[model samples]
Structure formats: structure tokens, C-alpha cells
Target: MSSLEIVKQYYTSFNQKNWNGMLALLHPEVRHEANQGDVRIGTGKFTEFLQKMDESYEETLTDMVFFTEPADSRVAVEFVVNGIYKKGEEGLPEAYGQTYVLPAAAFLELKEGKISRVTTYYNLPLWIELVSKPRND
Candidate 1:
């Protein structure tokens, strides 16, 4: 499969919350880096990370911006992830109710049809603002 195909497969499985499907596309030593303060490498760790992430989000990956440059062996995807938090915290207000959308971009490096490395960027500050408690001071 080509790099673009691999990326689409990743997102498609992600949207479905299919951990095994997503894992099938990753290299055994795949390294996943995110703006969310987690570093995960290796298939086992990566699977655990993904499971936790999927559990954290009330909404899933809904839309994707696609790239199809096969020569680069890389794929760049921009997407809007919409979800709700049943329980609120510092990054999300409790009384504000449970809906949030964070726009994100992820870049992936592929080798032999599997993801070797992935870097994800997103607006973490916005999430903080949405979830932050109002100060009494």
C-alpha cells in the first residue's frame, strides 16, 4: 500500500475506534508523539496509548484533510476532532457541559506500508480554556 492509503486507513480505523485495525498499520517499533504530553513507542505501548486516548474522547475523528504525494513516503492530515467530556476538569469546565472540538494536524512517516513515526499537533491552549475552572479572585 502507498503512504496515502496507509494514512487513510489509520484515520478510518481511528474513527471507528478500532484499536487492532489501527495497530495493524503500525510498525512493531512505531513511535507516536503527540502534543498531549505522551510519548509511546513499540506495538504494546502504542496500543495502550491508543486505548486510553479513545477512551478519553467522547467524540471521534470526523473529518480529514488529505495529501497524496507518494514520492515523499509521508502523509500530512489536518482534521477536526469533535467530542464531549462526560466529566470535566481543569482544561474543561464542569458546569460548561460536555462538548469540544479541537482542530489537529498529524504528519506520518511510513516504511513498507506501516507507520514508522507520527507527530501530531493541535491547539492545546483552547482545550485548556474550555476546561479551566473560573477563578474566584
Candidate 2:
């Protein structure tokens, strides 16, 4: 598959909450750079991160726009995260099923048809403000 197709599948698996599918597309020694967090390597570490995220949030990506380098193995995706703060995370605000919409972006590098690196970014302050407000319903 082409780099663009692989990246698309990655996000599709994410939206479907298919953890295994997502993992299948990743390189064994995948490098992950979490938004505002430390760098982590390997699928095992990625799985741990996914588990933690699954525990604290339920999110879907919307308004996705992808850009690829014609002669490189890089792909960049811009999207908005529509999410619910299902559970409270450490060092963050309490969660009361609060909802949030935040703009986010991810940069991915593909190697041998698998994702080898992923770096994600998002507005932490905006997310904090949105989730800080308790849901009315």
C-alpha cells in the first residue's frame, strides 16, 4: 500500500477502536512522540499508551486533511478531536463525562509499509478549558 493509504488505515483503525488493527500497521520498533509528553519506542510502549488513553478518554477524529511528501515517507494529518473525558487523568482536571473539541495534528513516518514513527500535537490549554467546564446534561 502507498504511504497515504497506510496512514488512512491507521486513523480508520483508531476511529474504529481497533487496537490490534492499528498495531498491525506499525513497525515493531515504532517510535511515538506523545503530545506534550516524552518520547517512547516500541509497540509494547504504544500499547500501554493506548490502554491509558482508552481508560481516560473516548475520541474520534473529524475534519481530517492529509498531506504527504511526494518523494519522502512522511505524512502529516490535521484533524479535530471530538472527545469525552470519560475518566480523570493524573495531574489533570476531574472528569464528569465532559466533552471537548480540539484541533490536533499528527506526523507519521512509514517504513516497509508500516508506520515507524508518530508524533502528535494538540492545544493542551484549549483542551483543559473545554474539559474544565462540567457537562450540563
Report every candidate's CA lDDT.
0.78, 0.94
* Pairs of colliding residues, candidate 1: 59-83, 91-131, 92-131, 93-131
Please give the lDDT score for candidate 1.
Answer: 0.78
Off by over 4 Å in 2: 134-137
How far is each candidate from the true structure, as Cα RMSD in Å?
Answer: 3.7, 1.2
Q: Quick one: RMSD of model 2? A: 1.2
Clashing pairs in 2: none
Tell me the lDDT of candidate 2: 0.94
Per residue, candidate 2 scores C-alpha lDDT tens digits across 1-137 of: 89999999999999999999999999999999999778999999999999999999999999999999986699999999999998998889999988889999999999988999999999999899998875577
**CA shift of 51, model 1, Å:** 2.0
Error of 2 at 38 (Å): 1.3
RMSD of 1: 3.7
What's the true lDDT of residue 135 in model 2?
57
Which ten residues in a row are the worst by lDDT in model 1?
88-97
Please, what is the TM-score per model? 0.83, 0.96
